[model samples]
Target: MAPATRYASGVSETAASSPLIRRIAHLDMDAFYASCELLRYPQLKGLPVVIGGGRRKEDDLLGKLQAAYPDGDWTEDSFAEKLDRIPVEFFPRIEGYTGRGVITTATYAARQFGIGSAMGLMKAAKLCPQAILLPVDFERYRHFSRSFKSIITDIAPVMQDRGVDEVYIDFTEVPGGQREGGRVLARLIQKSIFDATGLTCSIGVAPNKLIAKMASEFNKPNGISIVHEADLQSLIWPLACRKINGVGPKADEKLKGFGIYTIGELAAREPHWLVEHFGKSYGAWLHEAAWGRDDRPLETESEPVSMSRETTFDRDLHAVRDRAELGAVFTRLCEQVAADLKRKGYEGRTIGIKIRYDNFQAVTRDQSIDGYTHDAQRIRQVAGQCLKRVDLSRRIRLLGVRVGTLVKAGTAPHADKPYIAAEETPYEQADLFFTDD
Candidate 1:
């Protein structure tokens, strides 16, 4: 990798003359899931950490944490004492924990040994034998995620959530667009997140989302990189093809075959030649990506077309014998769906259900409501109706609920209508429903 170039000398001239000096910042949590684990077990700070587990185990751990520390202020020493009290049998064993699952996330320490998200657990163990592995505590992580993003919202109003791990923030309209204001604001946000959650992150300040995303990864854990428009050729052009957001395995392999392995090489290619080799749409996109031209906006609200929750059973249960048991699971799924909508400040007009039989045949059903809603009771009722339409004779391995036709929460709901019912049952709501709670 090439060293990132800086334009510290011509800041004034560039800011005044450049028409495309859009201030964008990309903030990514440093190994988010793994980092959250280490915050509790500080002894695991320098050690390799991995987070993965099934629904039940994760829920149980989250429930204990929520019950013990509702305020999210447990210290490192207190957390260590709590962990020591738990029995080893309750702790997940590498050999016994099995499934067709992949690692949800891993720490920077684990990444050093060539481990990463989506790698198989067995393979990760082989890479780092003594690595400390933990289950993904979705509820706790979601709580912290909301907390940090809310802090960012207070400082920078326009933010686009990439997922639980990262966000793209627009700082052009903020007071800190010129001078070192962007970097200064990024440092403050990073510090605030650390102080609030005891978690650290890497941030990149640049002219657009494309450059900002690339710049963020330039620095490792607990670091920042700022890239101005004038620094593009010296800094962004030398990166490998894989660094570009949309260039995946197939595109990378093809680029390598053509000896177009880096952004610099790709930029050197003729536009006509690229169009002839790749398709018109992709070829044009590749050329522009090389030049670091991205006009993507920073979205504050989440506009999801569909919302869903799914879990794989420890062992496949018979659909007939497990019908009663499945009811609880189905209700939990609906509650989670409703909670997700509430947190994102969204309401869905369409409700759907999905199931995967033991034979791996997937089935789905959907229904549109007369009005949009984020109420748990309404979502559960609609989901229940959809479930009855599906064939339940086959054994089920997984069940899920989905909601679509989403819009901003308050847009459709009248002031008099209560969106989320106060008496709604709390099934998986504890784990799935959290809005800075």
Candidate 2:
């Protein structure tokens, strides 16, 4: 096979070999949600912890206790000692969970049992019943995200924010960026994040974004991997095609049907053949991606296309039998989505709802309104209409609400249809799934 590029970084034969090589680093927080929780509850370290579901009364009690004694002065020794006094049993466990919540993220230890983000808490319970469960705390996560990104920008100014836990940084120009093929800088960033937040991250530095993304996952959890152009065939080709990032389950299955399971196999096929099969744009992009050829630059700032919130029920909810519960949950989701839009200073013209049946079939319905609005009641109203459009005969396992076609709140709204049609067909659900690394 011809040479294929993979990810590499930090002090090696390739370091300083060529100043022209554009070094891009992808840094990902390891078990980010769980790690953030660990900062608040250091006692949970090394335990099988999962962060998901909703906040419980226990969480509220803890908050009150901590607020009453902000510095842990209630104890004789220190806050650490006071924290230790809290029994392990005080933490909620995934066992016997009976809600429609999914694991947001699991600690590496819990991940050993085949549970991860998007897996139902009930399903994860079957794998590791004793795993601890915590609620999603976006406020804390966002704080850490800003802190860590600030650290990166201080080291390497040209960084692109990719969600709340990852970033793409350009290391081609930083002072020590070129040294050791970007390892020195990666190490510094990792140490800086750990020192500031008591969290760990993994980084991969390569010639471009695509290679760097794959490399970041190579070692994982406080690991740094460096990939060079020369390391492509040896490091990249043997991996499964899905490791390429864009090759999702559906795409991977199609590739497998074609007897192309690895990057090497995908690269061997002619670009024209891929285009003929997968269509013009995506096919050609896939061919280039398989060959480890990507020239996309780091986008320092990009507006979000949409904001959404969804949840999977612990048990399937019958549309009629659980009407009240479902209605409340549906309203809450729309409220949450609307709040997200308002918090981000965006209003959207398109409102949509997603439903997944007990049989795993997923569907979506969206409608465009005359003007963009981020009001909770308005969103809930439109989303409820979208819900009415779907066939509610099957029991629902998952529900989601989305707001799209966004614009800055102060700006003029787009020209949209005066009224939305009520009978939109079902579409596949596109819930974001975070994987265990």
lDDT of 2 by residue, 318-392 (tens): 777887687778778977998899898988877777776664445667666777778776777677666777778
Per-model TM-score on C-alpha atoms: 0.59, 0.62
Error of 2 at 402 (Å): 35
Residue 409, candidate 1: alpha-carbon lDDT: 78
lDDT of each: 0.71, 0.77
* RMSD in order of candidates: 19.8, 18.4
